[model samples]
Target: MKKYLGEGLLIVFSVLFALFINSLAQKYQTSQKVKVAKESLLKEMEQNQVIMTQWKEKHSKILKHIDEIIKNDSLQEELIKDHFLDIGALTGQENLISSLVTSTAWETAQATQILSELDFDTTQELTYVYELQNSIINSTLPDLVDIYFQRETHRKESLLPTLIQFKLHFNEIVGQETLLVTLYPGAIEKLQD
Candidate 1:
């Protein structure tokens, strides 16, 4: 009877050991998946920065053109203030996406006030539009890049090749306005394949 009891206890221990190992393996897989999700999110944010850069370049040229037309350096700076709403806010500002947009809209209101005051000629406006292709949007791109890389360094594991691939994909998409989009409204529809 003692021998039989010892054999039963041995089987029970074996079962429990197997269950624990399986649970650990599952947990490891889950951790990897979370890392992957975080990596993908970072890539998405990078691509959005590219789009923002393009828009900033275009807007800058537009403002410069307006300034040239108006023949005032003040107008150029004012246009930057107007388009960005707050130059300082964008320079190295760190905030979540929602608050950033709100701040930008505020600066834009100021720019619009200035734009409204202008009496631009059709030829000058047409020339501004023509320059759009060459101009670079200097929006919140650099800072955005910094934030993403910083976040990834903290992940500590499951830093797969997909992270590099995603960076490559982002570089390819940069300057491609089709991929650039605002954070709200139809952005998801535009972003998702």
Candidate 2:
């Protein structure tokens, strides 16, 4: 009877040890997934931040040039009289900024179910940032197309107000993007640590 009891105890211990090893393996796999997801997210965030900063700088410079032109009564009269042909000279053919936002990492993480492994707060913040990016892209499309047509058609007086209005809207979007970029670094660092 004592020998049987000893054999039973050994079997139970072996089973428990196997379960522990399995748990550790599962934990390690999960940690690796989280790390990969975090790295991908960090890369995407950094890229978006850089692109937003560049866009903001370019937009501000263009707006400044436009403001200067509009503030000068003489220039405004010249543009008005000449039908704003010089606006093309000032703004150039490439005035419309293309969207530089990317969502591949986010989409991949979602499709692979890795996003669920990320922290709740991090997921929420990422969602908010992407949503803002999408909004900025969609909102600016019509204005950009309008600017293109205006420039192409040389509709000076009409284009000026439209450009000014678009600039205002662009500034608001840039402000929101800047705020998101500012907040992203800290969150990424925390996750990395």
Candidate 3:
């Protein structure tokens, strides 16, 4: 009876040890995954921040030009007299400032369920930044394009109105970009930590 009791004790200990080892291995794997995900997210966010800054500067310049044209009656008259022929020449082509901003890493992390592994604050901040980016890409940009492409039979009559609408959209996009530029560093720091 004593021998049987010893054997039973040994078997129980062996099983417990195996389970502990498996649990530790799983934890190590998870940590490694989190590290890789953080690295990818950091790199992607850095690239996006650079792009947003560049576009923000471009949009700011365009906004300034729009303000100048709107404030000065002579400038408006010159544009109107020319039938707005030099409008595109005055303000660089709209398409030139509309470069594609990417969010592939953020999207991939979401799709793969890796964001669940990230800390709550980091995830929340990243979501906010990406949502703003999506807003710019999906909504603001399309509205700007629509306004630019909308036909006007009398360019002189429509110049002021078109400039006003363009100013509104550009102002919105620049504000969003500025917010994104500000948010990016915090997100990157969290990821690095």
Candidate 4:
């Protein structure tokens, strides 16, 4: 009877050991999956930040044009509102994007308020272009032009081209800037204006 009792105790210990080993294996697999998911998220965040930085740099180049439009006496308040809206868009601020998408609306509402004081029709395509050009000339369009060209060249040469290049192309037409600046007006001439 003592011998049987000893054998039964050994069997119980073996079963517990097997369960502990299985639990350890499961924990290890779960930890690995978590690490991999974290790495992928970090990579995605880094890539998005890079693209946003590039977009902001490009927006800086075209501020002059935007300013020119804002100052136009003939421009409608509605047109200026749109200009402000687009300008707010270039910043890629989280709060701004959230508000605009989920009931936050752009900080451009301030500009829109100022715009509401004036009365003019902004729907005509030709007038809209002229106002937009004027606003952009005074705004930071030059910076954007430089950034766009830089990225375009980088894309043409690099192998690991990101979807960012395609994203930039999809954004609204701000201005038609050839990748080559020398072929266009010198930056010095723009500053002189």
Stretches of candidate 1 exceeding 4 Å from the true structure: 66-193
Which order, best to worst by TM-score?
Answer: 3, 2, 4, 1
- State in Å the error of residue 27, model 2: 1.6
Q: Tens-digit lDDT track for model 4 on 1-193?
A: 9999999999999999999999999878666654443343334334433433443345444343344333553432433244222323333332211210010111232223322322233112212332343343333345434553553423322311322332343233223222212211222222122
Estimate TM-scores for all models: 0.33, 0.72, 0.86, 0.37
RMSD of 4: 23.1
1-193 per-residue lDDT for model 2 (tens digits):
9999999999999999999999999999988988888788888878887787777776666666667765776655564576654544445434546557787888888898888887788787788777777776776645555654565435654755754665675567557667766766765665575
Q: What do the candidate models score in CA lDDT, each in turn?
A: 0.39, 0.70, 0.83, 0.36
Model 3 agreement with the true structure over 75-173: per-residue lDDT tens digits:
777655755435464365554365667888888889888899998999999999899999988998888777756677237777778788878888998
For candidate 4, the TM-score is: 0.37
lDDT (0-100) at residue 2 of candidate 3? Answer: 95
Over the stretch 12-34, how does candidate 1's per-residue lDDT look in tens digits? 99999999999999878666654
Q: Which is better, 1 or 4, measured by TM-score?
A: 4
CA shift at 32, candidate 3, in angstroms?
0.7
Candidate 3 or 2, higher lDDT? 3
lDDT of 3: 0.83
Name the weakest run of 10 consecutive residues (lDDT summed) in model 2.
87-96
